[model samples]
Target: MLKRIWTIFIRDLTVNMREFMTLYMIIIPLVLAVGINFLSPSINDTSVNLALIENENPEQAAYFDDFANVELFSDEQKVEDRVMSRDSVAGILPKDNGYYIMTQGNEPESVLEYAKLLNVLYEADVQLEDARSEIIEFGRTVPPLKKMLVNMLLLLISMLAGMLIAMNILEEKVDQTVSAINVTPTSRSAFILGKSLTGMAVALFSSIACLLITGFYNVNLGQAALVVFSSTILSLLIGFIQGLNSDDVMEAAGSVKLMFLPMAGSIAGYEFVTGNWQIFFYWSPFYWAYKANDMILSKSGTWPQLILFIGIILAICGAVYALLAPRIARKLQ
Candidate 1:
């Protein structure tokens, strides 16, 4: 039985490698993750082009010392014009403590950081007036960079798992190998496991590629591997389930994407934006998986918690696999 399963897994993996599109699906997320990381310079290095609408009580531009290129504007119209022309990221309003953000599109993380900087400067302005010696607390109150980085990692990981597994199964269906494998001694569960294992392999390789490319030396390989492993299984389970209703690869891809829309949204803003939205995270497997991976990588979790989280992930994947197995069997028949 083990030999037969190994054969099945090997065949699936071999087929996945030969498919030209397989290379695209496997590497695209890595590029997105690495590209986003590389192209966008670190927040610390990026300049904040700012404009100040000199307030009635404002001193003659002596306070704005920390940021890059703080320009002076006489009125709201000038500030608005500068922002509309993409001249600056932020503007100090005519009123004290009021800052105007230029635009909300393109790299929300960048925009939010700029907002925090402006807010910090505003707080200092307030303190200087009151003759208080308080140090302005700003960026620390926002989500930490470490948390945001973890969140990005989890999103990319989940996406990698979901796309690699789901799409590969669809490719099998398209090439008619899924039906051929059905003639083997492969039980539906065993067959699913085989393909799931292949997906896990692809996801792990992607992670390694990320490590190699970025030299992110700090990853807790053991825990990260576990998370990727579990996530790949779930992705494979979803693929098998969606394949039942899809006669071709494209339909299967669409079905899988539709299935994971909720998860996708959670991936976009899980910890950074919706960390406190407990009710929102309830339906998202990505959220729980992210939490589990986070704990493992950060060393913030007890062993039991890791076990419990992995167990729950396995259980959820198992329950889903079990329910979908019969349906898949019926569909194949």
Candidate 2:
């Protein structure tokens, strides 16, 4: 039975590799991961941006770099051009041994104020250590925005696993190979397991790759993998149903994608809603998955909490599977 399942899995994998859509699905998560890493600001990064004529005011520019994001330009015109660009950047130009701050007039008040404060401090000969400021640590190293983006990517990739399964099954149906399963010494259980392996593997690989690429090396992989694995149950069921019921690739893909609605709703509720309103999202397995992922990313997830989330996810998936089993079996026949 294992050998039969392996054969089926290998065949499905080979066929998927030869197809453009499957290859695309496999590559897109990594690309998105790199994008997220590049776009997300570090926890210590300052929001204030300063454009300075470096050749004219090298010392001032060096001083400003410690407090804000300083973009050095060799000429005043370049500094003015940078300040006028889309992003909120304040430019400081030298004039008659004094400096003047230039703005596009639409920059945030805080940015302009911050640039003014930095310039004042520089002219006053105030060094950073002279301020006598003490830094306190609450021990959260990961930025919230980056963590949220990574978590969303993980959830979307998990859903994509189901899509992969649906596509694989749809291919079998289209090629008329699904009808040959029973006649080819493959049990129905073997066939299902074989079909599931590719989706599961893709989900695991993509999740891990996203984490590593996004600099989440310190995250608890065991906890993350457990949550990811448990989260796939519902998607896998949906994939099977969509694959069996749909007559073509487009219909299967389209139907499977409807799962995103609840996913988005759950994430929004978790992030935005508070107090008693939070109970409204408890019904969604994704809400629990998000909660689990959040805790995992923050390095604050306890084993009991992890277990509870996984249990809720699996219970929800089991109930869904129970409700759909008869229909799935009928479709198989």
Candidate 3:
């Protein structure tokens, strides 16, 4: 059975490599990761224009001005007018010796821009405090670029695993090859195992390629590989079911778009929402995957944590496969 499965897996993998869509999906993520890495310095160099109003302390004003892209304004009203007129601009005001961020705050991007400004000011203040004080401080946050890259990997792994499996199965289903395989000496378990293994191999290969191309080497290799592999299980199941259910590639492609919701939610919740709001994404498998990736990327991941995540992912996969496998096999037969 293992030998037969290997043969089938190799055949599917070879076919995947030759297929335009499959090859494209594998190449695009690596290209995007490289592009982002090349563009990131420029992106970081792009500064936020901030208006600091009513900051009478010349020492503090000079201190703030020394920070990047901050402009001091004498009149708060003029600052407000400038902010109202300009896009992606924010202002800061003195509040009880601290600072308050001022912005339109209507758009999400504006709110994020304001948050970035506050972070810069807060960091500047922290640097001054560190000079005066002896205490050390740490932040419980991941870098935004790393987080974005993890999310990108999540999308790539999940979509590619799901799409490859679905497309492969869909092709087999269309040609009635599944029924032929079922009737042959190959058991249903062997067939399913072969397909699943093929998808996993491709996903892991592509993920590692992307990681290397992006120069994201600040990660635990063994744990990172496991996390990457575990992350694709959900998508593998999704692809299997969707492929078995759909009549053709068009229907399968449309169905694949629906999985993007969870993928997007994982990134949004991780990057934007925090605290109690984060619990909303606890049920999302990609959420766990992203968190694990974040941990592994940041070099803070533990074996026990990875184990717990692995168990959780396996349970989800087990439940999904248990519920869907029989039906899929029956359909193929």
Candidate 4:
């Protein structure tokens, strides 16, 4: 059985390599991972340009300068104009005994930065010396860069496996290989397993390569692999369904792009959102994978939690397979 499966896997992989698009798809994850790493420094950086009314106190100007580019305007009106026009995130207007913070209700990060600045300004005696002493408390808070990087990796890995597996199966259907394979000793179960294993192999390899290239120093390799593996199952199931519906590669490709819409929901809901709004996205199986990967990358994911995620993914995969397998098998007949 192992030998038969291996033969099928090898043949499928070899055939895929001969196709330019398929080969490129296999390397997409690695290429993207490298690109994201090169851009990580900028992505993690939080620097804002600030405009301040030209005040007589060089002390106030110098204090704000430490955190951001402190631009001096001719007057309060110019400063207010800059803030209102969104030329800068916020402006500072020094007043008697205190400061007035001018901000637009826009970016959240800018608001947070403003609040921190407010704290520093409030505590300071409006003296440069005192402000300088207090400035040490303010430091750059790096966002969860690793979680984001891992999220992209998971997304690409799933996409790679999903699209390729669907394409592969669809290609076989188009070539009429399914009819021949069906008549042979290969059971439907074995045929499905072989295709799934092919996807898993490609996904696992691409994911590991992505992590290694992007500096897997702080990563839990075992857990990352498990997450990638589990996530690939969902993608493969999607691919299977797409392949079953598609008559050709172009149709499959077009349909796969639409698949990313729900994927975007999976990412946005899990990462950018909170509260009751998040529950709406739990229906997406990919979200469980995203959640698990996020927790695993944070190194806070327990075995029980990992198992729960894997179980949910497996249940979804099983349900999808049960629903689609018979319909797909009939197609070959």
lDDT of 2 by residue, 1-333 (tens): 999989988998888889999888888999999999889877876479988876776788788888888898888888888988987899988888888999999987988999899889999999977898879988788888999999999999989999999999888788888778878888888899998988988899999999999999899988999999999889999999999999998999999999999999999999999868999988899999999999999999799999999999999999999998888778776
Error of 1 at 143 (Å): 8.7
For residue 205, model 3's alpha carbon misses the true position, in angstroms, by 0.8
Clash counts for the predictions, in order: 0, 0, 0, 0
Summarize candidate 3's per-residue lDDT along 41-83 as a digit string, tens digits: 3323445666666555555555555554677677888878777
Q: Rank the candidate models, highest lDDT first.
A: 2, 4, 3, 1
Q: Against the hidden true structure, what lDDT does model 2 obtain?
A: 0.90
TM-score of each: 0.64, 0.91, 0.70, 0.71
Q: Kindly report the root-mean-square deviation of model 1 from the true structure over all alpha carbons.
A: 6.8
1-333 per-residue lDDT for model 1 (tens digits)? 667667767886676667766666776757765764655444354576666676633552445534356777788788767766633356556454454455424435765576566566666655445555666756432124544554455546555565556666666666777678778777766776666666677778776566445434465677767777776677766766676567776776677677466665655555557546665665566766777766654556776887777777788778877887788777655
In terms of TM-score, the best-performing candidate is 2
lDDT of 4 by residue, 1-333 (tens): 666778788988998899998898897788888887776643335566677767655766776677577788998888877878733467767778766677775746755476466536645545546544534523323237655776767776787788888888898888889888878788877888888888899998888788777766466778888878877877887787788799989888777767688777888888789777888887777788888877766667799999898888788778877887788778656
Candidates ranked by TM-score, best first?
2, 4, 3, 1
Off by over 4 Å in 1: 39-153, 171-190, 211-215, 272-277, 296-299
Residue-level error in angstroms, candidate 4, position 174: 2.1
